[model samples]
Target: MAKLFPFLQIHDFLSDKLSKEILDYAEARQADFSPSTTSSGGGMAMVTNQRISMTLKDLAEFGPAIRENILAIAPGIIEQLKISPFEIGEIELQLAAHGDGALFVTHIDTGVHEKSEKPRIISLVYYMHTQPKKFSGGHLRMHTLPIGEDDVQPVDITPDHNSLIAFPSFAPHEVLPVVAPNVAFKDWRFAVNCWIHRA
Candidate 1:
């Protein structure tokens, strides 16, 4: 293990061929995600303008490229957790847009549902924004605290277009607010969030 809490930036992790195929499939399979607006209207509020989401099974028609990436990334993430023989139960794509300061605030993505088999051991997020660089803000921030230390350190990750980020699910993290809006801001932020489990 390189570090107990580290953020990885794997650029161009998805091949062009696969990325193109997945994009096409995502286009056809994409569905508008309901507003997950938070009570607060600043750093972490989910926009009400536009959001999209798709389940792994729904995206299966897109071909093996998507599933292949999921399969490959999940196990590798587990290896980092020092856990072996684990499985991924469910995967989801979270697409958001800048609708009046919409952004995800600081919070841990632990299992939301009661008694979820997944338990969110690890979380894998893939950036699908065509122009990830042009967009302002929306950075994924990771926070870490030593076992007994009260002070927490933060790391910022803004992987280039088509990059992927994997880390422990228990880690406290949040998506920083998008400071400015762009022409592409009308559509979803375009990122896949997957939850992992023990095999």
Candidate 2:
């Protein structure tokens, strides 16, 4: 767990116009988002008090595009992360938004409790928010191996708009608290969570 892992980050993953369009689309579906949940390592998902955020299971306008791009670049991502190549399985996509006082504690993407048809291999998060961003904080902190609340080495990312990042699913990471003041959900920190699975 102490091994130094590799991560991929690309800026300007989409055009400004497209980024704005995605944000608008998300804002329009505020009602569709529900409280994010965590797995109990058994076979069931549980509502937790640790992570605070909202998520939408689908994003019709751009889900396909994101999937296509991820699939196209996944091999490079895995090679960069020094993982063995596997046939891509389902790509799980979830739209997430975090407003004031929201944060997700450190956790890995691999199932903490159970197994699946296709285990997650890589995790990608595409950040999107209004220009002249209305939110503060919400930084993504990827912990270097051997991490803990007391002693740890971490890399903090700003979650720049239209930027995308990828990392191994087993790496531990967390989102810092967000401060959006009085802005609406549309102005909150937005991200598309994608999981590349092994077939």
Candidate 3:
């Protein structure tokens, strides 16, 4: 299990103040949200109905902090995965909003496209949400690939505010369906999704 599904979870990755600030910025910029597509380059019809977008200039303040934090603990993650450290180039930051009933089916972050040259070595997700917890059941599930006809087991990680989760890009994972009874966009589950690529 250790070799097949290596993952790291860091609690309180950001202060309450900073976390709120980021969430506020996202809410204000919600108009820019676009339908997220599958790694296969397909349209929304092929995947779930969550909205996503690259960080805009307004989110510049978070770039350095996020990159530095990830790099600070990256050595440990690489050691656990037993992979050679590759130059971390072009850290992609994506803001994703999962509203009520939003869900993403299981998928591996790497190797979705056969002709792609750059490979994503590591995937990271920083979770944030409004206070009072208007939503429920938005967990990140990492599944173990069956070994020679063995049954797969899933590890569920709750989406707590200001927490960061990282795993190998090749690991299959999915975001469980969100249950936002209130159904307000402001109360939706938000995540700062990041991918570190080999150069």
Best by TM-score: 2
Off by over 4 Å in 2: 112-116, 147-152
RMSD over all Cα atoms, model 2: 3.3
User: For residues 92-173, what per-residue lDDT tens digits would candidate 1 score against the true structure?
Assistant: 4443333325566666666532345446566777776554444566778887655653454577887356788887776777
lDDT of 3 by residue, 108-157 (tens): 88742223456789999999988888889979999887555545468999
Model 3 residue pairs with clashes: none
Candidate 2 similarity to native, TM-score:
0.91
The candidate maximizing lDDT is 2
User: Alpha-carbon error at 42 in model 1, in Å?
Assistant: 24
Model 1 worst lDDT run, 10 consecutive residues = 49-58
TM-score of each: 0.69, 0.91, 0.83
Candidate 2, residues 144-198: lDDT per residue as tens digits?
8764344435789889999999999998899999988898888899999988888
Candidate RMSDs in order: 5.9, 3.3, 3.9
Give the clash count for model 2. Answer: 1
